[model samples]
Target: MVFRRLLGSMGVGGPQVDTVLAGGAVVPGGTLSGQVCLLGGESAERIEHIGLELLARVEAEHDDGESEGAVVFERFTVGGGFVLGPHEERAVPFSVPVPWETPVTELYGQPLGIVLGVRTELAVAGARDKGDLDPLVVRPLPVQEAVLEALGQLGCGFRSADLEYGHIGGTGQTLPFYQEIELTPAPQYAHAVSEFELTFIASPAGCQVVVEADRRGGLFSSGHDELSRVSLGHADAHTLDWNAEVDGWLRRLTDRPAHQPSLGHQAAPYACAPPVHHDPYGHGAHGHQDPYGHQGHHVDHGHHVGHGHHGHHDPYDRHDGHGSHGSYDSYDPYDKDDDHRSGPGVGTAIAAGAAGLAVGFVGGMVADEIVDEIGDFFDGDDD
Candidate 1:
């Protein structure tokens, strides 16, 4: 999609600018190529420069409350010091590299609601005008996709995705905010946790997978949050059993002694878990089982599952908080575990199937909205 907006800095009879992004979502650190079209106004004017700005609608949290604003994270000067003849039209094409820390906007082709855009600004004579604004769609890297795909196979469904306004302590976090992909717990593990939230931080070396489980609480025991971090290289993803690996991650996180409290702190063990079972066919069944709970204000990280000692306090065993514990037709093939952790079964299978169906359509919707908005604002005449 493309956006073309007249330059506000110049009254009528000034030049206009329009920008169009290439089709489909680009990956982080990938090149975004597009064209900027300019139409000369009443008479030929000296065009000083043409610039492109990368914009994002980010959430900001403060002591008092929360607010959202459009922020410019990157800028590129594409065409400048040129001349435009009266009634003349020119097209300037550019290929720019996106920042590695760029937040992903889609997965399995689904919209994650992380809005991004490109704005075109033209400087004519001494006046500067903001011309266009369009949406930007970004897909996850290969490794990132593999991990999410694995989770889907494990029976986790896509919950709402959003960007948080705080830095994750004890990690190589470059952005001020991070994106969280929330998921419904698999059936077996449903009794252990209400839900799980996953975050991925990818770099040249490897990607970090952060899992946070909201365990269910029983009487006399308060619920606590468990966090686990793991790192995986591009080569290791295919060989690893993502189901077993993710299950192990949950176990280690939940098993932590409640007495050792680390608020806002992520625990260690930055290694990928080994693969569960190798499938001869490419369609591997690995995902979460439990159905999703009711939608709440935020991904409730406060659900109590089982009890543990934070210090001297003891927590109790619990059920998955996703409404009635009535059993559904098993979707995946995995067996259930005490803490809701299950083997490869119907629960995991169903999650992977649902996410696959939903991601493509959602992703395209978001991509079209973003690109079209940008084109409308940036791609047009400047009179």
Candidate 2:
């Protein structure tokens, strides 16, 4: 019996835990219900506490370059305070509310290459172990879906999506990080802009949409970024003609003069119009100061420019007078190709004049590879 206690102290025969999420994909601001199954080992163990943490793989930009790490955005304590007899089994069920700003991992049943997970930490007798981790699937909210669908209808192709570790100034951002969905410009606007980065901040009251464009340079002019934003209520998703609304926003975004300031900034050309919020840290939002006083606000745009150097040397290898763009040398299932090839070719088809975004295009080899890569990522992190 003494040997068994020593083994338990050493975590050789302690309680084991496994968490299983209740249902299919859940949306942001929705409940995540799951069961934490526990099985006792050779000896009885004192159950101290059980915690569930919501984690996201976020990219951080720093002086040395960029690095990816897991960020625990939320934590919940469900149940504990009991002793589990040897070889016994008990399941603790819990339902917790996810944050309103949780990044969406999928759209229309297709994976967007964003990784999120729920980690179960089991505490026993002063020792804690992360027993289980499950991949989380978050679908876009109605307003978010409508906007992306509208972009697809307008011939914009999905490029990639990632969670950037930083706060966007001038908005009611609750989370420390925000999601950026990259999209290729449609033929009509391709001549003026290279790409568009879309960000949505959702709240119970409404949603804020920020669109940043990589404006193309002329024969003598240098390229720069342009930003615009707008607000919409939940009902507007179904009420407004999204195609027209989104098209108008894009038209104004690309057509604005190079020297003119965008909306929300002081002395912006559209000062008289309803103000649209933007990231003060974003590049080329002329005249706007970083409210956070963050040192590396200029580096955000440079990160996008570094995407071209992917599959080669480290993008952040050289400072080159430009801010540190960082490197994505690690496994990126959604890595963008130089010729603009994307995962599953859904966006390519959409840009090729498909009626709308299709479902289930992520299949066969591409699907298997994505699943394998994501599985390896989470599994390796378990160590």
Candidate 3:
């Protein structure tokens, strides 16, 4: 989608900015190429800088309750330092790298109800305005797709997906938040687990698969959550029999004791293949840093906050000054009280077929409604 908006900070007859992302959905850790079209106002204007921000609709847990807001995950200064004459038009092309942990908004071309957008920020004469907001479409990487396909083959159906604000302790999670893909349990495991949530942290070397199972309670026991982690190389997507591999992982997870702290760095119990081990924090493979120098957890508070470089404070930005590191014990992925909840019979089913899981529409909203919601979100209207 192309979003066109006038630089309102410049008052009437100011320049207009339109950002258009290239066709096709982007994958995590891939490059996002787009063009920012600028139309000069009635008078000459000095453009100081043009910035592009990657924003996600994130949910956070607080002492009072849960709240959803827009989080600026990454930003890039694509163009700047130019003077546009009256009525002149210019197009600034940009090719920026997306963060490896960026959330997937779709699977097989179907919306997962995860909202992400690219907003264009224009600065002129000490005034800045985030004038345009366009919806962002991100598809799963090959490894991610293979994992999900395996779950489908095992009879696990997709429920819903969303971005949660917080860090997963003892993992190489770079982003301030992570994506949770909720799925119903396969028939074989239904007696043991009600559902499970999947999280993928992809880096240059490989991807980390984190699975959290909502296990059913016994006659005298209470239900609890169990989490497991495993590291896999990119090539494993094509080499491993994902159905058998994933089933083994789930069996081990459900059978583990509830009191055990996470299955940290453990290899999956796949007998066909030997244990695959890789460093979880191997960022040195590509020498990558947090894309945004700040832990940009600034909340929009149901409105559009100014895109300034400083003076913005977020109570939820719990990082240690550096954008990359943080430990949040408050954000629980298993909490069901959050406004967004997806359970069995609560969302559109991702039907299992001969090939695998077939793509379906979003759970709550259709395609057109999602577009409208995106417009409303950028317009500062939470309702």
Q: Write the per-residue lDDT of candidate 1 for residues 226-256, one digit (tens) a residue.
A: 6666766544444556667666676665554
Clashing pairs in 3: none
Against the true structure, candidate 2 reaches a TM-score of 0.70
Instruction: Compare candidates 1 and 2 on lDDT and give the better one.
Output: 2
Q: What's the lDDT for residue 294 in model 1?
A: 17
- What are the lDDT scores of the predictions, listed in order? 0.58, 0.62, 0.65
Shift of residue 298 alpha carbon in model 2, Å: 27
Off by over 4 Å in 1: 1-5, 255-383
Over 4 Å off, model 2: 1-10, 260-375, 378-383
Instruction: Tell me, by lDDT, which candidate is best.
Output: 3
Error of 1 at 354 (Å): 7.3
Cα lDDT for residue 63, candidate 3 = 63
TM-score of each prediction: 0.68, 0.70, 0.74
lDDT per residue (tens digit) for residues 1-383 in model 2: 11112223436766677787887887765567888888888888888888887778888776688888776676677789999899887889987665657898777566777878787777788977776767888877666777887898788887777888665554456566789888889998898899998898865555678788888877655567766767676556556687898888898877866543334322211111111132212111112222112222111211111121112221112222211112111112122242322223444333432222222233323435655655566655642
